[model samples]
Target: MTDTATPLISLTWTDHITGRRGHLVVDRLVRGVASGGLRMREGCTLDEVAGLARGMTMKEALHYTPGARYIPLGGAKGGIDCDPRAPEAYGVLVRYLQAMRPYIAHFWTTGEDLGLTQGLVDKAAAEAGLTSSIQAVYPLLDDEEAARRRLADAFAVEVDGIGLGELAGGCGVAEAVLAALDRARRPYQDTRVALQGLGTMGGATARFLTRAGLRVVAVADAKGTVANADGLDVEALLAARDAFGTVDRAALRADDVELPGDAWLSTDAEVLVPAAISYCIDSVNQERITARWVVEAANMPVRPEAEALLTARGITVLPDVVVNSGTNAWWWWTLFGDIGADADEALGHIRRSMRTLIDLMLARAEADGTTPRAAAHALVADRLPEIAARYGWYR
Candidate 1:
């Protein structure tokens, strides 16, 4: 494995509000605000948090935000190791809020990530006395309900010209998929996809693909996977999915086969999507993958080793920066316009961005004999220092 010093970044957060004092490992603070998501899971680690922050750094540079110039408001991320479903989560979250209060008031802004809910975010924001004015980097919705309303308003009425499946992250991915398909000169309709994790990102991506005329043969959630080689019943799946992507397996019919949790990886589809967790398809499970194309809908779903293995096998792997353009797009809109109008508009922008980035990256990879991951990194690395230089931050 290519080794480098722990990426230069600052990280300091309260382990437990009542326990240890919080710490900070900031590489460089651009302005008063450093934005990132908070991951609450049992397995979260410091290194992972730093990596995500690095990604934010790259993202901010690529987009050239105001801090992108004068200061480096690269992205920052924080995680608390706890299970969301556990009763302890609320207490832990409160402690987290209490510990992070000082930073949240100044140079750091935290948002919902894995295991974090809107209710939790609202509660924390309330206790912190957070308001719209505090949001110097991204525009903050007055409240969580407003954020949801914005999303609903944007998607409340579906456009007639767009297919139902062509509407979500799947649609965004579909754009990328189409680009990849075109580059290989392969026919689009014959392509099939099996999706792991059917949450907002996964569900949207699946639906969009279906609408784009690609067949979704398998889909899975935390509960279990449901497969139908002929094609999954997207309508039925959506009808049965709960607020948090849970499906009532009791209602599932006998015709559908239930497979172990990671069954989505073994499916015989042209494309595979690991849209669940970060590093879900790590080195251990990388060998079992059967798809020729792997698209990342979730952030950092594949580790370096797994990604390298896939690349060596002649598989097309799309990096999260380009493939998971959905969230970044939303964040941009949230930071700029009124959150309400920007939610849906953000999705449209994400699709276009992913399509364009992927198309460009693939062409570059093929022409240069470099892997997709390397190509994406090179692209980010090239632009980041430029942003730093332009802003006169590097000197």
Candidate 2:
């Protein structure tokens, strides 16, 4: 196994105008290149950035397919401690990108993560005169229509009638949930799901799960939690939500019962999805969770102690590395120009890829008699030495 103690590089920057601090951490580099996402949150810190970068490394390694001979990219992450809603956000992003331009152009590439978007990444990249690191991974398509679709997918913008990339991440999680249910011979149509954090990822996941025939009984966001035993109207909630996925406090209906933010944990739903902030489910709250299965759409949403507790209680906790890999798969497809011209085809490919990955992870977990998190980490650890040796970095 490889050591996880140190990252390859870590850098910090300050925006003179906004007085904002930013950090870029590359946990590992393969062939001298790494990629991850840029996160902007008021509470984000360098340590969190480093942790996320390490997660990205493991994620990329799991995404590699031997059949395709795909060499996985290394893990790296960028974070800025600032409010994304502030008026100075754009300026801060510009300054941050300018400071990170060299790494962007030469060694590291990043995209949208929590509190950030692909549009912002594009804007800052353009300002820095740097091509997106995504462009480097895949071959350039000669067809103009395909190129347009590719850009639309990457930037989460509508182009030529194609919708945004909001569904990518959730769709992956939905597929993983379905796979897990199928493996257990559980009927998804009758399964009740409680979703915490109805933000972009959670909202999309709710929509996909509902469409796939699951009943989402409860939903929550930053504002509050709402539930209907019969099943919440996901479409109505989506319509009522703001662009940031916050439902107005005054928008609750007569039948909707509002609860404290953490009350979602007490719901008797068979499936629970945590898609909001990190460390949301910890030792203190783990005892309250009633879901038999927890799919992590948000990175590190479950603390180690919480996960261990849940596992001890016979709850199946699917790690974010596998459950929330749809966007990463989308990025892989986009980079290699593997996705077809049609949107449906692209989505189908993503879902299929998710299913395959989930199956592999589950099988590995069963064989090793370990949790999916350990299985995934072990898989990456097994491959790291070979990768490092190839790059002449192994001791």
What does the lDDT read for residue 50 in candidate 1?
A: 72
* lDDT at 210, model 2: 95
Clash pairs detected, candidate 2: 138-335
Candidate 2 off by > 4 Å: 1-4, 67-70, 133-149, 153-164, 249-253, 385-395
Q: In model 2, what is the error at residue 271, expressed in angstroms?
A: 1.1
Off by over 4 Å in 1: 1-9, 12-32, 64-73, 132-171, 251-254, 338-345, 392-395
lDDT of 1 by residue, 110-149 (tens): 6666667444676766665664212444333345555545
How does each model score on lDDT?
0.65, 0.80
Best by TM-score: 2
Q: lDDT tens digits, residues 1-395, model 2?
A: 24767988988898888789999998877766787889888878899898889888888777776554346778889999998888888889888988988787767868888877676778777887776645534333355456546656564543332244777788888998999999999998889999887776898899889989999989888767899888888877877787567887666677889888877888989999998777889998899988889999998899998999999999999998778877866765664566644557667887898898788888999999999888878888877776676664521
> How many residue pairs of model 1 clash at the backbone?
17
TM-score of each: 0.82, 0.90
Q: After superposition, how far is residue 353 of candidate 1 from its true place, in Å?
A: 1.9
For model 2, give the 10-residue run with minimal summed lDDT: 155-164
